[model samples]
Target: MCNDSKIHGFLEKLPKCEHHVHLEGCLTPELMFTLAARNGIKLPDPETRPEFSSAESLYTRYENFTSLDDFLSYYFIGMSVLKQQDDYEALAWEYFQKANADGVHHAEVFFDPQEHINRGVLYDTVVSGFTAGCRRAEKEYGMTTKLILCFVKHLPASDASKVFDLAVERGDFDSGVVHGIGASSSEVGPPKDMFKEIYATAHSKGIQRTAHAGEEGDPSYISAALDAYKSQRIDHGIRLIDSPSLMERIVKDEILLTVCPVSNVKLRCFDHISQVPIRRFLDAGVKFSINSDDPAYFGGFILHNYCAVQEAFGLSIADWRLIALNSIEGSWIEQERKLELLKLVDEHIDKHLAD
Candidate 1:
C-alpha cells in the first residue's frame, strides 16, 4: 500500500469516538437558517450581510474571536434560534448525521445548559430535544451517545449547582441521556475552587465529572480540577505542557484531555499548528483525545481536526493510529464497547493496508 494513501484511507474509515464536542457548537449555518425559519426567528440578512452567507463566512467571523468570552457571544447568538424541542432535535440529528458520515460510532456530547436556561429555554427543553435525537440516532445510525451537562464557568458556582440539581430533579439525566457533569465557558473567571461544592454534589449523586482546565488558564487549573473535583477528564488541558510535574501527574493518573485543535486555533490558544502539544503528550504517554469543540464556528469537525494536525506535524501512520486509539481510551462508553471499537479501528487499518 502507498504509505500516505493508506494512512489517509484508514483515517476516513476509522471507527472513532469523540469525548469533547458541544451540542449548539455543532449548529451549521445552513441548519441555522432552516431552524430559524421554522421557528419564525429572524436572522441577520445573509444576502445584504456577506458574513452570514455560508460556512466560510461563519468561520471567518468566528476566527476573529480572541477570548473565550468573544467566542461565547457568537456561540449563544447562533443558538438563539433554537427555541423549541424540534429545533434542539434538528440540531442533534444534524450533528449525528455528520458524525455518522465521518465514521464516529460513539460520542459524549457536551451542552451548556446555563446558556439556554438564561435565555428562557428550559433545562428540559434542551435536554429532551437532544435526548430525542440520541434515541433516534441510536436506532437509525447505530450510534451510542451520552450527554455531559456543562456549567458556564463565568456564572457563579451556586448557579452551576442549581443547574445540576435541576437536571437531576427533572430526571433529564436519569435514563443515561445525561451521563456526566462538566464545566465550560470562559476560563479566566471563577477559579477552579469556585466549583468545588458543585462538583461535590455531582460526585455524591454518582454522576461522572470533568472540567475544562489548562486550555487558556495556567497549569494550576488543571491540577485544581483534578484535586478539587476529582474530574475523570480534563477538557483542553493544553497548558499542562507548561508544568512538567503536572503533565507527569496527568499521565500517571491516566486522565483524558479532550483537545480541540481547530477551536484552539480560532481562539488563539496556540500561535500556530506546530505549537499544539498533542505529539508531546503522546510521546510522554499522556492520554489525550482529539475533538471539535465548536465545529460550526471552528471550520472543521473532528476528522478535519485530526487531518490538520496530522499534516501540520508530519505525523506518522503509527502516530495516527495511536491518536485514534487515544479517542477510544478517553471515551465514556462501557469497557465492552470500548474494546469493540478498538477492534474495529484495527480492522480498518488492516483493511487499508491490504488495499
Candidate 2:
C-alpha cells in the first residue's frame, strides 16, 4: 500500500510498540503445517475442510474472511498444532523476528491461555514457550517485551477465572512473567463485563488490564469494558469513534486504542482500509496505535498496517510521531523503557525530517 518510497522508509524506521498482536495468531500456514507434522497432529481432511488441503490453499482462504467467527473457526484449528513448549516458543519467536524487522522496539503480546488449557495443554507449556520467545527477542534484538495472558470470554467467566487464578498462583504478575490480564474472543455476544471478577482481581493485584472491545460490537462494549473492567488500554477499539462521549472519556484517560488496520479490512469489519477512522481518530485527538492484530491470518504485519494507514489517510510526519509516541506511552513497560522508546521516536522523526 505504501507506494511512496520516502514515506515507506520513514514508517519503517520509526520505532513501534505492538500492543494488540496475538501470539497464537502469528502461526503462519507454513509453520502450522510444519508443526502439525512435527507434533503428529492430524488436520482435517481436504474432503471435509478443503482449506486445510494445503498451506497455499489456506493462504488463499484467508484472503476472504466472511466474518470474525469465520476466521476464528480456522484460527482454532490452526493453533491445534501447537502442543509442546517448543511449538509455542517457535510460534512466538517467529512473530518476534518479524516484529523486530518491522522496527518494533517494544512489544506487549497477547496469548490465549484458556484456549490452550482447554485443549489439555499445560499452562506452564504455553507461558514458558512464549516467555522463551520474548527472551530471545531481548537477547538478539535487545528489544523489550511483555506478555499479556488473555482469557477467552466465550467460555464461562468461571473458566477464565480459573486460568486467571492459576496465573496468579504462579506469580505471573508479580514476577513480570505475565505483565497483564485481558479478555478476548467472540466479542459480540459476551458482554465486556462478564469477566468482572477476573479484572477486579487483576486490578487488585496491580496487574494491567485491557480487553478486546468494540471490534465486532458497538461503542457500548468499549464503555462497559472501561467502566466495569477498569481496562487501562483497549484492543481493537475502532467503534469508539462512533461514540463521541466514550471517545472523549478514553482521551481524558489517556488510554490507548490498539487499532489493527489490515486485520479490520481482512476480518470484514470494513470494506476497505479507508473506512477504519484512522484520520477521524487523528482529527479527534484519539490516542491510538497502528498494529497487526494477527499478522498471519490478517494478511499483514505491523509495518504493513502502518503502510495501509499511511496510504489510506496520507498522514503527515507529525501524525505518525503522535501515533508512535502514544504506542510507547500505552505500553506496559517500566518508566525507563517508556522514556527510551519515546526518545527513539523523537530522534527518528528529527533525523528523517533533517534528511
Candidate 3:
C-alpha cells in the first residue's frame, strides 16, 4: 500500500475516464440554488426540507439514504430545479470542469431524458444545451465527453422508446454528442427484458448499450442485462460476486463493470467502503473500473472515490494503474482514441516513477 501523500499525488496526475456518472446527479447544492433562483423555481421550505438548508446539510441528508430508492427520491427532487437550456448547459459544464481538474481526460456521462421530458422540458433543449457544454469542455479543457441517454426504469418501456425515437428524430443521436443508450433508476421490478426492444432499436441504429444492474438487484439481473438486453457494459455490477457462474461468464465475456464504491456505500449497498467487492473482482480476474456514480450526492468526485478505495483496500500504484487502463479500454470511444489515451497513461506513470 502506498502512503497517503503518494496516493494523492499519483491519483491527481492519473489520466482518468469516468464511465458511470449521472449528469443530473452531479448537481451540487450551490449550483442547485443558483439555477433555482435563475429559473424562478422556489425551493422547498427549509423547515420541511432541511436538506436544502445548506450545501453541507443536503450532503448530510444524502448520507442518510437507506437504499437506492431513498436516494433516488432526493435525486429527482434536485433535478427538478433544472428548467431551461442554459440550466442543462451549466450543469454539464460544471461537471466537466470538476472532471477536468481531477485529470479525467475522457468521460461517458449518463442523462435521464424521460425525467426532464415528462416535466415539459423539451428533449432538444436538454441535448442542445448538454452538447454545447461538451463542445466548450473540449475547447477549454481538452476534456472529451460523450452523453449517454438513460431510460428510467420506473417509467414504461414505451416512454423510453419514445425518447429514443425523439433523439433520432431531433438528430441528437447522429450529432456525435449522444453516443449510447442505457437504463437507470430503481432496478427492482423493472427487468432488463422490459427494455429489450428499446435496446434492439438502439443497436439497429448503431448505438452502444449498457444498464444499471446487480447493485440493488440479484446476479440474475446482471445475466439478463447481458443475455437479454445485450448490454455492452454493466453499471454497478458488484452483486455479480454472489454468483460464481455469473462472475465466470462476465470474466470470459470481458464485460466491463463500472463499480462506484462511494455511491455503493452512500446508498447502503455496503455499510462501509472496506466491504466493497473491488478486491473480489481483482482476485477473480473480472474486468472492472472505479467511478463516482453520483459525486455530488455520494460526497466525492472520481478522484476522491479512487483515494477512498485505495486507502480502504491498501491498493498499490500498479492496482490503480490497472483500474485506469480498464476505464480507458472499457470506454465507448473509438479504438484509435483509446490507444492514444493508454499511451498517455503509460507516459504519465513512467514520469511519476522516475521522479
lDDT of 1 at 288: 86
For model 1, how does the per-residue alpha-carbon lDDT over 198-280 read when each residue is reduced to its tens digit? 78877777789999999889998999999899899999999998999998999889998998887888889887777899779
Clashes of each: 0, 0, 0
The CA lDDT at 159 in model 3 is 93
For model 3 the local lDDT of residue 70 reads: 95
lDDT (Cα atoms) of all candidates against the true structure: 0.84, 0.90, 0.88
TM-score of each: 0.93, 0.98, 0.96
**Residue pairs of candidate 3 with colliding backbone atoms:** none
Give the local distance difference test score of model 1: 0.84
- Per-residue lDDT for 162-270 in model 3, tens only? 9988888877778776899889999887765888988887878888999999999999899899988889999999999789999999999999999999999989889
Write down the lDDT that model 2 would get.
Answer: 0.90
On residues 82-153, what C-alpha lDDT tens digit does candidate 2 reach at each position?
Answer: 999999999999999999999999999999988889889999999999999999999999999999989887
